[model samples]
Target: MAARWLKVLAAAPLMLSALTAAQPAQALVPYVAVPAERNLEGAGLGIAQAAARLLRIGQADDAARLAALTVQLIPDDPRGWVLLAEAQLRSNQNEEAAVSLAKARELDPKNAGILFAQGSLALKDSRPSEAADLIREGLKLDGNNAGAYFDLGNAYILMGKSGDALGAFERASKLRSDFWEAINNQALVLYEQNKAGEAIKRWRRVVGIKDAAEPNLALAAALNVAQPGNTESLQRAAKALAEDPNYVLESWQKEQLWGPRLRSAAAQLLAQPALKADVERAQANAGASDDLGDG
Candidate 1:
């Protein structure tokens, strides 16, 4: 169910603010559309390559299947094993992912990507110390990997090192400006550090940059807290609910991502009468594509 939600989130269109030319303060909305091409079928190329392409296009289930097949097809290739682990991880097949990662480790003990993956799995398992050490070693091998830096940020956050996490997130954003996930986490770290003003600024930048549920909601909630009962802020919150209603409808608490502080903000914003009514309306009218209920 979580995997399905990820696919929906990945494919959804940018739902930016409906702005007029006169609103000079409003930032221009960035639009992004993922290409819809499901043509790869493990043809001519190796199964790992095929799986990688599928995974890039938000087809994790299909990618996992292909990756599983790849291990059987090319048992000696550590790349196949690593690909399988990645696909399984995406599909939320944690145990299978572990098995695949272990096999890849046996084949190539120093593989940076595998080490990074293992680090992520360790983080997921709540072993932040181990995760941090593994990722640091992985970074020594591949210092240029933005994704690894992002994962390292997650480890730092779990370890309650907000300052370190912020640095990691900043490095990730420097490496890839379009890495909104890292930017979002930076906002989270800021919030965790009690830097509400700075966090709100980062959240607003993310809302202006893209129209994802998490960022939009963060901006809405922070704006509400900054200026309670403000009509414009309420409207923005309404707009976010209109963009993706199910987060409120299902009362989906993504504490793993948002943490207690942000979740409390979201709850506070949701409790607002005007925004609550607006969200309930959006929930009634929204289709499946606009929903992310509970998962």
Candidate 2:
């Protein structure tokens, strides 16, 4: 059955294209191919598999709905519960996700994916010790889980183990080069280690992959200090402020993403006449947009 499924998956792209061509006026949407229950043997497995594919494609709400039906269809299948938890987590329904994960763990205590999700929630809740332990155990079970390593790095960062955090982030990057969060955090670790040059390099790499406002903001501040009056850095700062002015306001707080020293540095950069002017314009625009809603 696995071999047959693999063959079907290999042919799916071409088949999908032909199907799309048959309906040229409509946008193409990929769908899960589930055989009839008589052919597949387990309807619940087919539904759960579809839910997993939906979750992968950034359709978390749909995935969650399907996964809910899956658990009803096969209450004994731990995978359905785990899939539901993943979708809920993606939707930021933390408390509900925890309940689903708990049920999944009760059904399959050693499931690596359940452990990874539990670790992520623990990290988000500021329980670094528990997160670190759970994520480490999950990694031992699923050595190729890049996201588990990324969470482990976050746990280490919260624990002030910058060196260990760097190692974990590096492993995650090696596994998935496009993991921008890991690279962004790697820059944070470097900045904390007082290696401004290294941090700048990583920040540049991160921005190259995506125009993430946070990394751009951090890079602009670092460049402002490391090479005062650098034109390109000033442009980066302007772009960040224009793209995400709220970051400028929130970044001034003591609890921003960077450390105290970097935050202080960012404060200084934010005070520059040109950057401050752009941020003010952005804030005014946002205020106007909000005011329109009040009518």
* Best of the candidates, lDDT: 2
Task: Put down candidate 2 lDDT per residue, 26-118, tens digits, no spaces.
Answer: 444556343453433265577678778878887787778768767865777788888899999887788989999999999998889899989
Query: Whole-model lDDT, candidate 1?
Result: 0.76
RMSD of 2: 11.5
Which residue pairs show backbone clashes in model 2?
none
- How far residue 19's Cα lies from its native spot in candidate 1, in Å, is 66
Root-mean-square deviation of each candidate, in angstroms? 17.9, 11.5
* Model 1: how far residue 196 lies from native, Å: 1.5
- Model 1, residue 247: distance off in Å is 3.6
TM-scores of the models, in the given order? 0.72, 0.75
Model 1, span 63-157: residue lDDT tens: 88867766754566788888888889888899999999989999998889889999989998889889999999999999989998999998898
lDDT of each: 0.76, 0.79
